[model samples]
Target: MSDKLAILGGKPVRDEFLPYGKQCIDEEDIESVVKVLKGDYLTTGPNVREFEEKVAQYVGAKYAVAVSNGTAALHAACFAAGIQEGDEVITTPITFAASANCVLYQGAKPVFADIDPKTYNIDVKDIERKITDKTKAIIPVDFTGQAVDLDKIMELADRYNLTVIEDAAHALGTEYKGKKIGSIAHMTEFSFHPVKHITTGEGGIVTTNDEELYKKLSLFRTHGITRDKELLVNKEQGSWYYEQLDLGYNYRITDIQCALGTSQLEKIQKFIDRRRELVRKYNEQLSDIDGVITPYEEVYSNSSWHLYIIQLELEKFKAGRKEIFEALKAENIGVNVHYVPVYYHPYYQKLGYKKGLCPNAEKLYECMITLPLFPKMNDRDLDDVVKAVNKVLSYYRK
Candidate 1:
């Protein structure tokens, strides 16, 4: 590959653009979806239950409820946690907007908390500082698949009597203190978007050890309707009797998607292993590049490595992240930025959220760049990314 910067009209790294993330669908995944299509039920069937059980078992959680998507999963979790009007839920502003939006969905106020600059996860101390009499729960995101400080968060939750609804959208396979993320948090939500470790086309789930929460989550997913004889207020009416116990949305995921999810789950360990391998390649190759800082690995947890991000050292680079990002794009390296702080959005600003609320998160947003990472990428693809990054950064180095 030529060393010339592609953005400057020199030879590019590759002919095709490589996306930052993609789903790896195999024959088994296709077959599973086909099987569900041929079956009698397409939604609200045995496949959904089986998939939920598989997810719950894999994460060592007692129950798992599947929802329409990751955002729905967060909303369902918030509803299950009883986050209502006038309540406050604390969460890091560094994550995808859905993390905070879920709180808003419940008519609750989302309190923005700063993040730990090293791990990119919510700072537990900031979470503590944000707690108030109105604070009902904490929605801590395991940003970049790195586990948050669960022990400390749980201690604070216990002391404050706050519900911990962990937004584990980036941490399906992450483990903390030898326990899987879904099992450790009071309630953990996982996304199955194509970019995530697994794909259900577009789906998400919430795992919890509490049966009450499980029931609530199940109800919340399907318009709060339930046919359970024990909970029915009019059980003697008829066998077809069902009741909507509370206000909920139509967030039920289809059986076809769940079947695909189950098949994908069968190979999740392999997928996660490949992701970690790619992360290793990135770290080993980019370590000497003084213009960028690699992601920090936490000692107490094993990340599933959903996204490999590098923060540009602006002081050492002549150009900013935007210029470098465009340069990498020109090189056919599909780099992306994970997030803008949730409060930075116009809607949030209108809702009284200010820009300077979370300084650490805001700073991270300015420099971090997400590089291509997926299980199916070959060694050559990995090399192309590294080469493109080096060429772009080297050209921009002051």
Candidate 2:
């Protein structure tokens, strides 16, 4: 059968194409975007402030600064946290490249730590082992929406006088213990990409409770140009007068994106609840599979369920992970891998980063596969995914 025909056939079995993750847009989101489009300020306006305020309030953070993308948010957070040249920033290897690259962008070095095999987040013990006199910060990523062990990390950070910059791009609604991720970290970054819990086309936000850090991030999100007379050493009495303090980029987010984000934020609770339901179903369905290990959540952590990841046990299956991935794809299931270890990339390798530095992350890199899990998925779509997954796994087992 043709690929198109197979996809169409699967569509009937499913409500729609089961994207691994996606944005859930509604009438409110549309109306907000339309309102922004009709308004005079399309770039950096009142809606941006409104959205930032709402996010900060929701996360129990004192301030939030909207930026162009998650990467930009990370950059702003690192800068605001005072990362400087030759300083070492500890982070997990099993994350998006942006997590480590943000440290490099500040002329600092990124030091890799192993991840906790169960949670796939930066291991607090590994972080402590890697910390040195040059260590300046800990960039703990909430991988796959599971909150890292923040209590331990915060304790270590306090001991070392290091800052914590949370790569919470996958963990907007996730929590550690009773506190939210954004509020617990010294600085937290969130992505509003299509694949994230929310969507703003392409946007991110930096959240912080420290007033000084918040002010610094707010300035960095724009052009580091401030119109506030209080920040200026010499006040100029002109409406257009502004001071360019730090070298910054045009990382500002548009009002249109903020409007969309605000709309999406309104439904975040429902989105998170449905995702947990889907995860429960997946866990029940896949738990008995001999060669599969489902993602684990910590007792003290509340995951956002951004992506459902499972590891393939190569010993139990006749085929390799790649073959199983291909089989699922041929069955019209859109499965994908979460990431390769950041240090495995050419850029990091060129900088003398080596393998075996993070054994746990490297092991995960070989077996991890992200299954379709999103707020938009219905019962039919979920069932279709389960059926396809079972078919692939059965073949490999045989």
Per-residue C-alpha lDDT of model 1 across residues 1-398, encoded as one tens digit per residue? 34777778788999998999999999999999999899899998999999999999999999999999999999999999999999999998888999999999889999998988899888999998999999999999888899998999999999999999999899898999888899887899999999999999999999999999999999998788999999898879788889999988999999999999999999999999999999999999998888889999789889998889999889998898899899999999889998988998999999998889989989999999999999999999999999888888778788
Give lDDT: candidate 1, residue 177.
81
Query: Which regions in candidate 1 have their CA more than 4 angstroms from the true location?
Result: none
Q: On residues 1-398, what C-alpha lDDT tens digit does candidate 2 reach at each position?
A: 22222323432224345668777888889999999888899998999999999999999999999999999999999999899998999998888899999999999999999988888988899899999999999999999999988889999999999999999999999988877789888999999999899999999999988999989998886688889999986695687888889988899999999999999999999999999999999999888888889888989999988889999888888888888886777666778997989999998899998888988888998998999989988887878888877766765685
Count residue pairs with overlapping backbones in model 1: 0
- The numbered model that scores best in lDDT is 1
User: CA shift at 394, candidate 2, in angstroms?
Assistant: 1.0
Q: What is candidate 2's TM-score against the reference?
A: 0.95
Question: Which candidate comes out best when scored by TM-score?
Answer: 1
**Cα misplacement distance, residue 342 of candidate 1 (Å):** 0.6
Sliding window of 10 residues with minimal summed lDDT for model 1: 1-10
- The collision pairs in model 2 are none
Q: Which lDDT values do the candidates have, in the order given? A: 0.92, 0.88
